[model samples]
Target chain A: MKSKPTACFLLTVVLSCVLVAEGNRDVNQEDRTIEWWTLSTGAGEHDPRTDLNRLIAGEFHEQHPHVNIEITPLHVEDFKKRIQIVVQADSPPDLFQSWGGYVMFEFARQNKLRDITYFVNSTLSKLISRESLAVYSYAGKFYGAPYDMGAVVVWYNRKIFEHAGVPVPQTWQDLLYAVRRIKDAGYVPIAMGGKDRWPAHFWWVYLAMRLGGKEAFDTAYGGTGSFTDPAFIQAGRLFKDLVATGPFQEGFENATYDQQAGLMGDGIAAMELMGQWAPSVAKNNATTGKGLPHLDVFPFPSVEGGKGDINDVMGGGNGYIVGKNAPDETLEFLEYFLSEGVQRRLIEDQGIIPVNKAAARGQTGPIATITGLITKATYYQLYYDQYFPFSVGEALNDASLLLLTGEYTPEETAAAINAAWREFK
Target chain B: MENIKTLYSVKKLGLILLLIGPAFALFTTFVVMPVFQGAYYSLFDWKGIGPLNDFVGVKNFVRLFGHEPFRTAIVNNLKVVLFSLLFQLPTAFFFALLIGRQKFPGAIVFRSFYFFPYVLTEIIAGVIWRFIYNPQFGFLTQLSGLIGPEKTEIAMLGNPETAFNAIFVVIFWKYIGFHMILYIAGLQGVPKDLEDAAVIDGASPLEVIWHVIIPSIRNTIMISVFLSVIGSFNVFDIVWAMGQGGPDHSTETLVTYLYNFGYKRFAFGYGSAVAIVIFFLCLVFNVLYQKYIVGDSRS
Candidate 1:
């Protein structure tokens, strides 16, 4: 009996010591650490973006000596998959990259994100554009902030256009004419990456935007209409028409995005409908290492008699969302990171279109062209995959690709999308 | 004496249990538990995240059977199975017989060369093959160019009809060595005396192989068939790494279908349903095989 009492007392003492050690660890953790998960901007050994990130981080550390910031950089696809697992495990990094739209909305809906609406409306509101900020917003509440926003545009090889004797297309008919001329000139008109289905979907989505503009999308997405709307079907039909012209390179259906970039960079293909990252990717993938001597941007041409203005754009942006349990300093760091000076540095060096209104001043060349389109746009729509639920987004990509292959008619494609929406909505 | 023998047997049983306990525990925790959990999850309309409150019952299964892509996936898996039995196994067996026990100069080099592909990871093999299949700038194009300039560009993977066949060729190439090695090991067990007796009886080489060698190695053949069939059903990494079961989902296997529909779309419930279907398919095949082949042979 005495031994039992003595053992109980010793057990309590040991347990209390263990508890105290754990308590100390918890306090130590709270005092001085933040984890940031970001996508690596470059694939090679000498990446200036990584250097810039470190420079900014060093500056931040100097400002806040007590807090230590740890950045874990991952490749884009790896980051996406890892982040999903991390978020599901309920131990997301303090700050992490997000491509704002339905995916972010899903995270927000699940209460996995920290609501930064207060910070957005108070201090950072004046710094970034509302339109750019809207990408990261969900249900009228801000969950993240965009640092880089860009529009999809036609990236053309100037030499190829001159060789074919075709001017830059300003209308759908003109674009079709250019395609015919380019093909007749013994070159593939467009370098498309159909194996990675998102590139192909861009064609259909852009057509939908050109045909119907914001109202058609709004009506369909707002539950007042259906995805099988005439405008959407017409978009599919137009995409099929483009596919029928044999615009894409040989084996394009199996070619990856890198391969498509290679084709454009090598001047084997005339044009590619891609984002701002096209030039850099093409340059990296080119046989010459220097890519095209003359590369230029043109907007996706307007459809004849369409409701959409030619200036309306289809695009999205990269941003960082705060995790649910992130420290207050995470938001502070984001604000510092997105300041005008930092944004300008990123723009000048990284070739990204600035989300900061003040930093938008010195933009030139292709970046300037995209910035101008964003500013003059009548309506800015996010990519369909980003804007819609995951299932519906996947269905859209599948349906669009099928339509491109002539495997599914426009009507059938529309029905497939509508059916997926019904099931998953 | 009887009491001493009983005690000794008890000790033997204790030793056996002790040896197996840790592995059994691990397998139960990791494999068996997850399999059961997956089955349970198949009953709900749950995303991978959050609580499992939405009980969907058999709706996921019903939907899977009705899905066109799933049907395509099933057919693709069957094609793989058929091809493996018809082409892959026979090729491996033929090679095994050719040099399995033969001691010639550079025989070891030949064996290693044949086994080289099996040593390469599935993803690496897929990537290498993708480059080889590239229409514009690949070895295939160069080879075709030798034949004629007009034949230089051929996109076998781009065509839906040929995509699955191309993947099948890679599968056959990568796994043939493994099956060949299995057959070689089985051949080593065949008694030389039995072959000599068949030869002495004026039997031809083919007859000797059919009557004596094949009967002796039937167990190994059965096991290799079992492994090949299971492997065909679970072929995901190669297909995924190559085309992501694309060019219009033509290369989709059952596992790839499960991944694309379930994990990619966050439809965990539906994915679990797919898992259950795959499990049952493998289970039914294994049970029937064991009963008809292994059990019958043993008896």
Candidate 2:
């Protein structure tokens, strides 16, 4: 909240005051309590997304009567840290948000999570596709289900592009040229939240996908190859060229992701690279509570002579997992929360790319574009941080940051990630 | 008489143990034991929650020494200590002379003004200063933007080169007042007749300060220096609140380095190793400083 505008706090107060529907909530009639921790669109109590979450929890509580779901919405980073502490202490909240990857698997390996494989097989499988739930599965046991899945793409302000006379870029070279034009037009070409490192990793990871395709990553992870392979190093060099352009906002290296969202929401910068949730976050961070009027997204551009197709996707999703100590009612609440109605609400209001296929039937424009890419993709890669242990993921973010800051050469950046992989593995 | 003498020696031993035994045991268990415990833990490759079976002896230390950020943390910590001593000395002395020597109009007001930042919590001071150093619409940037080159933002904490200096400035501002207050109190202990006699002997004001005030406050200055050095090694909240030892680990002190690499990465073994390193550094400094600079004149 350093340098955070006062209006967001005031607005949160106003929004939090906005009452839920009368039918949504009632005092719980039972003794059992569930702690439901979630990753919020904004940090702390200054969240816009939590209203919808609170509404869902309240509705769930009303119907259940015996099981009270106490919602704790945390910012993404805070959520990770808090959950890590709780999980390590072996007193995980009844249920908590999970991105469904090595982190969740780590929890499962430590026997900290409740195995919901039987539930997934009998009940949830019919609703959420098996492939989507595969993320939350470890060694053939399902622990959670994905409610939203999408790809990282370039979110841009059309007004800025038009003002700069720049066309939508279709290739890496075009993107670079567009950045220069947009910068020359006196707008920050890229609104990077560099302090939050992961945002910058998307640049390198996506480049690696487009350059080396999925094979490089698979081989590297399988120990047949290494992250220091040519494609990974090449990704670093390309990312370095983009950083050399100086397209981000002033003081970008220390700016939080929220600040980046605010910049996009305010249309103070031309572009940001983010997932499906970008628009809602930008709106929440915006001065006007309505983000860029001309917000549009384009797929990450392909590099020339790259082995990967343009449709090869780099993405992940948001979901929930149950603690081992969770009451029997926790699954019922999670299932209800992931039911079509709530998923639809999440999609419509929060710009979520819904996991429930029925809920995503008619998304038009930018969202459909993302959904289509994921559906038709030759490869779909989870975020490196999510795919690997948290430490390796952090090292990847750090190494990418080094490349972005010109602190590490491409080969060195590649070596750093590889070293962490070997060490942590 | 021999039997009485034996009883007296035994009684003396009993009295000595009664005075020092509990404290020694407590110190060994709480203070001294944890350092050795940390040293033991540092030998294993353990995450925070797991078993300590992976006995990678001294591997953590080897990695720590090879880690660039830890080296940076050491340098940054030393710089903090040096800056506090070098910058605080003159400012605290000047203020002590200005306000403590002679009370004038609004002298109390000036003292309060000088001491105000110290009263504010370190985190609050850091956060407030972070806003002041904010890259875009910050007070400093906005003001400088008016006179500086157009479209060139001078981001103090964002640039790796300038971030440490920016943090140092904040640290200096936050603690200088405390040191000044110490000096002021020290100034009060200076004998008035000694100063007047020196003046009567035709000593200049500078000479009087050098000969009288400086020597008189030596003990206070020693305590302040010790605190400053130890506090520098322990500085975490301010640097962390401001930068998290970032803009590419440019502002990392030893403690933040310990936190980021050890706890954050969930590599508690490496973190304990870092703690041991910091412990030894502090220990070495404590022994040398006490034995040499603070010798014999403790009273």
Candidate 3:
């Protein structure tokens, strides 16, 4: 009887051991995969992130067989707000789209963004350009990957120009002449949207660049150059002069980006000083057999003796970044994205420019021309508000709009900018 | 006797605790905690997510005094308060008196129509107003065209001279409905015997409303005025959506300016300072209102 009880106990112990082993095996299988969250604006019925998630998931699973990417597309504005909240909550995205500026730099400083120099040196060096990589650099550390270059260029309505008997402007003087002629023909010269202060920033920055070359811009942004400097004041004056031309739509200050683009699409304006992404708008509006106005891109023209040339760039690159908290498997997904084939897919299929050097540049439109300009250029200037300290950038946007709308004189506008900078510093 | 007294006191204590516990916990989490965090953030020169920030004491406030847009934002907030006082409250009171007691044709329908706008979210109302004020396609411009082509380009929300008023019109359209509803409640609460007695004395409708209805609804009037003041001071979403407070910061409110400072420009410290100023201003207004206006109403 004692032996029977002992035998039963032994049997139970062996079975319990096997069950524990089986449970551990299941956990081990689950441990190899990773979860990735991509911040995207889930617009329309079909989310673009869903397609990207599927592509990355397919490749990642095939290669590692142990990784999974979980993509959640938040609204565009919500994405930025969520990052701050989620990071504070101790759970952030694995990878996301990041503008290589103060926002990303702040993340990098906070150690929320991984210093991927170690990984890039070993695996991603040959895949990206040195110039492209430089964009993601801050304080001597490379933080993220450059995904797309948002190079600002002028988008002109060719049919409007042809109708007005004015050719495409090749120089600053030529641009003014074209504007005058277009005005005489009773057509708005430019479709600028001042409703969003950032859009109005383009004119100020362009004029600032024209008046004060790169060195002057560097000096001004560095807190040494005065906004009250003759050059800055002159830029403000130039802005006022442009506004006086009555070249913008009647209610341009109320016009949204869509409205501004719509004006060009409807032949209400002759040209738009915008980024290369404008061709996408053209393509979108070209559905009718009548088609959109013939579209062309150009660089901002030179000032009389200023060193800024027709080829000097006024743009920056947008890039994908891996989170510092991302698991190692997430890095595998980035490697796939940095590949030439995927880069080409982004360009040819999605209209986004790829940062990879090996990506074939076969896609047409403003991306090709912008890439050409980038590759062939000798010098470049970062956009103004991008480089300005936060408070001053707001002041710049406000001052420019206010100046154009007759709220501030040229001198007062310059003083306001300087005062804001003083406060910021 | 001692045991009975102890039991009574204990029961009272427990009841008090039960009554206050939920609200205290909620207030700590939502209000007190955020205020403390904002105060702490104001001390640091943090650009959102960064490693180390320089702690600058009171510099953010000093900076605010010198910044022009901040000044403009304060001025603009004052303008909004003035506008609400001049237009929204009086109009709402007038309509409430005119319509509250009547049984005219479609009176209920008209009351519902007046109340409809208050039901809309601010951004939706802003969009509707945007279309109504649209430069090229809006009915306003179409009507303006009846005058002349030059007048047709009035640029209602885009022109600096009119942008603030355009935003005010939208705010008025939306919130006047709320005030009207409040006034309806107030008017209903007014004693019908007094107004009937005034009419028997040969008082006109306007005279009866001015003397009897006005005094009776004094408490509601006080509440409405105070709410309008706070609402106007904190105006943000409508102004933000409508031309983004632009055509020269003509419509920029303290809240929108704070938002732009913090989110758009990444000056969290400066934004927090602006927020604190707005907070103090609200506190002052509330205190003054309670001390003077509420006391007057009671009297």
Candidate 4:
């Protein structure tokens, strides 16, 4: 009887200890975990994004002490598809990157996006611009935080222009002159990638901005009026003329983005009329040639008879968004991310454009150049396709590809756009 | 006595149900249901999202007919099917017979070499051919340099003229081995005495092959041809990897066009309509093939 009592007493003590240990583990599990999914490109056997993610995670963890952020950086091409698949299935990352306009609009319409209006109104309004917030708004509600913004700007290879003895084109006429001059000098004036359908939208957006002005673009894309305006027709003609000059590399319609980037990087092309994010892509690809230092930007040269001005910016926002179904701790983490310190770190270290205007101007070095551009912008043309309805946007993207490939004449392209708009509406 | 008979019948019925129950359920859930859903979705216009699905009847199919490129994709698919029937299946069968009858040193090694490409994933095969077809840095281009610039400019898969043939070449090289193995298995079933008797009758090698060998493996050839035809029509990876039907979309096949319309363009309704057409075509061809070509053959 004495031995049985002693054994029971020991067993009770062991059980109590086990319960205590389990309780501690539960608390630690809640405290130490964070989850994030990002669309990180260029990840191969040893992706740079992996190291970057680890470093950011390490630093964040060090500051938080009791937190660990789980990061999954997916391949670039697969990013949108994977995210859509996951998020639509009611399982979403704590934080993800989504572009402004229709891309966010679709997610918002599905009620898949978190309304960050309360967050913005309460604490974020003072830091982030209302303009930036307005771009992320859909049906009068903010769906995401602004992370980066860029206008579609022409980036030129200085060496190529200089070798061709063609001056940098300041006006619309000068651009045509440069194109002809560069072509005569035996260097391709422009290296446009038609293989990547998304990139083909450049000519469309540029022409839209040039002909219709920012407001006309906004009205057309917002599904207000007919897209078959004479201005759009004129823009199409200009695009055809540009194509007629044969400024692009031989068989450029078949060339991939990387091939075009390679040509521009090697000084084989005088100019690349693309978005501001192109500088980073160009810089990364630079090897035997001096990269960004030898590169400079300008807004698309003003169409002489067009209403658009030189300062009118054309670009879209690429930024991070929090999930509506994310855990409470994730919201807290996002709050921390929006803090000035983190925003500053993002701009300074990562070269990522911060959504906060304060963060933008305060940033230094290469990021400052982007900041300068943002500060100087008098008007911004949001990426038109993203602002348009899904079907309309898709049709426009198709029309752009068709236009470049000579599958449709300029008039037909304009007609197609209007037809698509009518059908979609 | 009636009870006993009924009990026996019930037991037999139960056994019958038990044998087919799982298989029927599996087919119903996986294949039949999805196909039904696909057919249903084809009638409606939806982005595969939101609460909205607008029923537009056969308008999507009408629109497809109106589109020229889609018609081209269907033609391309037919071309691929024809290429497989005319070239890959026959070539593979002939080689399989030759290898099966011969007794060479390291014959197994030679067979393994032939089957090596068949083991590779489609993506890997595509990448390998893509490298070979590279205009600037490809091995073929380098070899062509030894010949001349005119040959180098052939742009095998890049040019519209040669793209389909180039793709067919890759398909043949990769899948011929699979059919070869099939033929080899069938060749083993051919009675050696029949061939020996033919030889004893003063029949030539070609005659023996024609009268005995060919007839013996008729079933295998039919099956292989059917598989090759289906596979060729369904191919998307090679064309996608090579140039995504570029240089003016000349190389597009049905599957690739369907993928482009559905995924890239987000035209799910039109994409589904395309898929339904492909499905019906495959069904008709399969039925016709089995009835007229395959079932009639006796070996």
Q: Give me the candidate number with maximum DockQ.
A: 3
Cα lDDT, model 1, residue A382: 88
Task: Please name the candidate that would achieve the greatest TM-score relative to the true structure.
Answer: 1
Task: Tell me which residue pairs clash in candidate 2.
Answer: none
True contact recovery of candidate 4: 0.20
Considering summed lDDT, which 10 consecutive residues are worst modelled in model 1 chain B? B145-154
lDDT of 2 by residue, A342-405 (tens): 9888877777887777776787978888888777776878888889986788789888777888
Candidate 3, A353: how far from true, in Å? 2.5
Which is the better candidate, 2 or 4, if ranked by DockQ? 2
Better of 1 and 4 by TM-score: 1
lDDT of 3 by residue, A244-359 (tens): 77778889877887777777777778888877666566445433414363677777776676656566677775666777777776666788877887777767656666677777
Model 4's CAPRI class is incorrect
| Cα-based TM-score, every candidate | 0.93, 0.88, 0.88, 0.84
**Per-residue lDDT of B1-299 in model 3, one digit per residue for the tens?**
99999999999999998999899999999998988788888877776754436899998889778867678889888988898889889999888877876778887887889989989888888888898898877877788778675556658898877888888888888999899889989988888899889999999988997899889998888889999999988998888878776777666788988887766777777678888888889999999998888877567
How high is the CA lDDT of each candidate model? 0.89, 0.87, 0.77, 0.75
Whose lDDT is greatest here? 1
TM-score of 3: 0.88
Model 4 chain A: lowest-lDDT 10 consecutive positions: A361-370
Q: What's the TM for model 4?
A: 0.84
Estimate the Cα RMSD of every predicted model relative to the unseen true structure. 7.2, 12.2, 5.3, 6.7
